[model samples]
Target: MRYKLGWASRFGVALLMGILTFSLVVTTAPTQIQGAIAQATAAARQQQREQQVRQVRPETYDLSRYPVTDANERHWRNVLWTTGVVEPQEPYVAEAIAQIVSLTARSGLSRPQQRTVEMAMQIATQLYFSNPTGYAAIGQQFLQTVERSPNPEWSAMALSALVKTGLDPQQRQRLGDRLRQRFPQWNQDIYLFTTLRDLALLQQTPTTPPLGDLLKWTIAPNQVHLYVICRPDRGVLCQTVVKDGNGQFLRENGQLWSIPLLLRSLHELSWNFTRGQTPQGIYRIEGVRPANMETFRAYGAYDLVKLFAPYEEGVREFVPGRPGQLPATLTAYQALLPPSWRNYFPIQQSYWAGKAGRGLFRIHGSGEDPGFFTNNNRYPKSLGWNPAIGCLSALELYDDTGRLQQADMPPILNALTRLGGRSFTGYLTVVEVPGADTPVSIAEIEAAINS
Candidate 1:
């Protein structure tokens, strides 16, 4: 009986040990599996997040793919308005402007277009100021659209509206001044002027010349005068002169000339003097005489010739003992120019002249000598002679000589093409005198031109 009892006790102990081991295994196995699954899921989520980051990274916009055109302008305008990319109260004003633009597009009608839409909204805002209860709701809606837009034109229009709403005089003046300084072009819009004038807003007067002058100067189209003077005492005085048909300078007239005029004049001058000249070109520098020895020392004669010769047939004729003779060291016509100007002349002259199958083709002066004469009649246009009509004169010369090339164009096209369709409008706005910096390269310029 004692042996049987002992056997039962041993069996019970073994069964209890086996049961405890099985329970421990079951609990630990699940925990290890769960931990492994969690780690895998976390790793996969991290990879997906990294991929998402890479997918949405901003890419450089290829301007060439979207060249400036009427269609592209319309498309971009629509995209900006529809996507609320420009204006804030986009839902309200967007549909209105879009409707107007759509009607114009479909009917092929010529409305004031963008400026017209802006003017209409501005008028509405003005009406709201007089009758706030009647027009305030719509004015507020349009104001919201103006606030949301990144477009400068819309911003100008909205600010104009705000001025119309009778803001504090000082505040209105400040805003008007800021807008004028930032966007001088917008200041020319008649709609803006009329709105400001009617509201008695403190806006700057438009810089446009009289209509008579504009019509008279239509021969020049858009041209400004860039004068470079080499005085006897003063070394060099370069000033960009803006002139209307009345022959009054812009500064003297107390107004900014049209930007188109400034740009055209700058481009024409750059093409003629810096680029080079031909019979077709109409720029000329007259009455250039030998300077005193001191004058020669202050401003290099060779530099002057190199600078001006591209545009004119520079002829220096002075005897060794001549009363108005420059220094003997400044004997060479090319040597008269500064080292920098001398070096740049050939490169610039060649770039324009060579491409056109012509040379700068100007005569130069010999050492302190007096027997130089210009065949002004041989090259009537090349002589330092410019007609009253600016671009029209040049065009007439090209037409008379039958030299206007149908295909060959200035190197500007090539340069623009290289810029990948970016407009040279800004860069071309400011006119830089020669010997400032090297102009853009031919290859790069070709790109900009083509674009």
Candidate 2:
């Protein structure tokens, strides 16, 4: 039985083998097709994601404005970035970093000049997000370089860089201790106070507000008291807070003025001193002129809080016009001052140059009529974003409807009124610190949060 059917059975075996091979091919075809489709879908999704990243990337700053030949212009721009006046976009950051690196390889800059470059490097690195490790290394090197010198400016800048890099506490503490021991001869309390705050922050200890305390420490000995710290460069949009005698915040009746402030205009700069820029120091709010008053009405301000005349009282005059003028009144004023106070000007003039004016500066309502379109002028829009004469710090009252509201008036009025109505006693103390020739970065804010 076994021998007779062998050749015929071999044909059946071959047919069965062919059927199994066909079935295997049929099963695997769908798997191969599915894999191809999945690969195509993934590739399409990856392209979409890349497009999204490209579309949403931040715009680069215009580098042509900072030509390499113009060191003053470039340095000024660097100051702006360091102080948060102008935030450095990625391109600016990279450009600054490259400049610093190149400058480091060569030598010949003066100490102050070198400090400026180092400061710019600190600012650029802190703002940059892409190269944290590289930035940190540069910051460390900067710290070492500055530590060798006794210059507090360099020390302060280096400390700022360390703060921004989020240096570890133990290392930060050691550096801070060294800074404290090294720089007692430094005159500016800003350096000491700022470094103190940085040290406290690093060690996880309590820190007094650097600017607030610095202001308090400076003015504490003087007879004039401060009721509010009007920092037009703080908080959301901009925060100016009112403080009490103890330096505690006064929240009553909207004492906190959280509104945009207008700075300076080109036309105004021609005639008016301070160049329409907000002054950087403390000034006593000696008196107030009401809106009904003819003098202020001519100048187009609402309620006027007269800061202590940086010059002799009634000596400097405001020359009124479309493009206003300020006369050289300091010479006359110096004659009237007692010999002691007369010398004070020479010592304090640098600080008071911006603070002093020809006597028309005021925080007031916008000149534009709220309801009517007598003109197409936007007072607040111009003022808040930097367009005012030397005297005007215009408040924003315009609502989303383009109509001005009285809401802006209450906070300023309330603080002034509560202090003594038209006879408020303390300095107006308008500070936009760490900027506009005074350099402070928002990294201070970040350190505060970490603390």
Candidate 3:
């Protein structure tokens, strides 16, 4: 009985040991499997990170080697849109597009090819604004390229982008329309002409002449205003205090003149004309009268001297006398006038005289009289009078005659500066009427003009 009991105990102990071993295997197997799964997941995650990095890595491109043809422009466009091309460590896609556009435009390509590049640039600009990722970098590059581009389209595009980012929809639309109309062909001539016209128009008051008429009369060279004209024909006629047959003030054809030709002649005389052989006293006399020497001293001679000095260049020899001095040949003066002003003399004369008196004198009255507004009234308020038209006319005269000097150009410059002052900076706002009393900053105005 003792032996049988001992055998049963040993069997029970063996069964218990087997059970313990099975439990140990069951618990450790799951732990091992879990560790393997964790390591696999880590490896997969690392691989994905590496792949993403590679995708965005910069690839070398031979930009110069790529032929800049209209057909190839599409390829450049695609490069800009490709994902991950503008990563931080990579060449910026926006910068690349700008470079491509500029190079393509200036590559001596055909008109169609140039146009294609412009279209591509416009599309790129649109994309830049639409997505606006890394927009600051994109904008900086765009501005740099635009300033360097000869194509007007690039400038217009840059301006539009600025408007989009800085201005409200209404302002943006208005400016965009104006820019589109002005730069329809994207050539320098049209672009520069439109820019000047728009700048002049902005300063126009209700009393200003029609835009067409203003353009016909006003001439500008290097963006400065010279002289103003009233009529376009009979050559610039005026009433000045000259020594006349009766020693009285008389109105006559003082001289035939334009600004551009005058400046050219003056420059020639100053630097190129033969010494002594150059004619003396080229200005013609209109009349002489019992006049106020004080008036002559205050404005007349000074004004004429300042007006003529642009052409003098230290070579002009003039007859030293009273306010009324006549010259032998007015040919030099006549040549300076714009071709558009040749037949419109009547209007040109009136315009010229009116401006000479600082819009303070008028011809509407029976005799030359003070304008309705006093000189005191000629402050910022008086800027409303067709000052833009007058200024533009003056500029035209200067441009035609080459009389527009860097100095003595404050009045015309003031008109432009004031006009530009009506805009807002880093943003756009459209005022339907340019002369509205809306307050604007000088900086904003400058930005709008430059843009």
Best by lDDT: 2
Q: Which number leads on TM-score?
A: 2
In model 3, which range of ten residues has the least summed lDDT? 424-433
* Model 1 Cα lDDT, one tens digit per residue, 1-451: 3432332242343233323332222223445434323322434335533433332211211224432234445543433222221122323333343333222122232333444443334334333433444544544554454344334444444555565455777866665556456556743553334334333423442232122222122112223222211111111111122333233433313332211011111111112222112222112222212322222212111111111222122323222222232232312332433233333322233222222233223212111101011112222212211211012111001111222111101111222222223221101111123232222222322232234
**Model 2 lDDT on a 0 to 1 scale:** 0.40
| Total colliding residue pairs, candidate 1 | 32
Give the candidate order by descending lDDT: 2, 3, 1
**TM-score for each of the candidates:** 0.19, 0.39, 0.24
Clash pairs detected, candidate 2: 262-383, 262-384, 283-427, 283-428, 284-427, 361-391, 434-438, 434-439, 434-440, 435-438
What's the C-alpha lDDT at position 139 in model 2?
Answer: 54
Better of 1 and 2 by TM-score: 2
lDDT of 3 at 431: 16
> Which lDDT tens digits does candidate 3 get at residues 342-413?
333222222222122222111010000112112212223212111111111111101112221111112212
All models, RMSD in angstroms: 35.2, 26.7, 37.3
lDDT of 2 by residue, 1-451 (tens): 2311221242233223323432222223445433323322434335533433343222322335543333554554444333222232344445444455344434566655565555454444334322455444445455664465444544555555555456677777777777767776543444444445535644563322345333333232223333222333321123344444454444434333233334443221211122323443444455565543223212222345565445424522222121222233545334432343333322233134433333455665443322222111323223222233444444433333332232243345555556444445444444443333221333443243234
Lowest-sum lDDT 10-residue window in model 1: 388-397
lDDT of each structure? Answer: 0.28, 0.40, 0.30
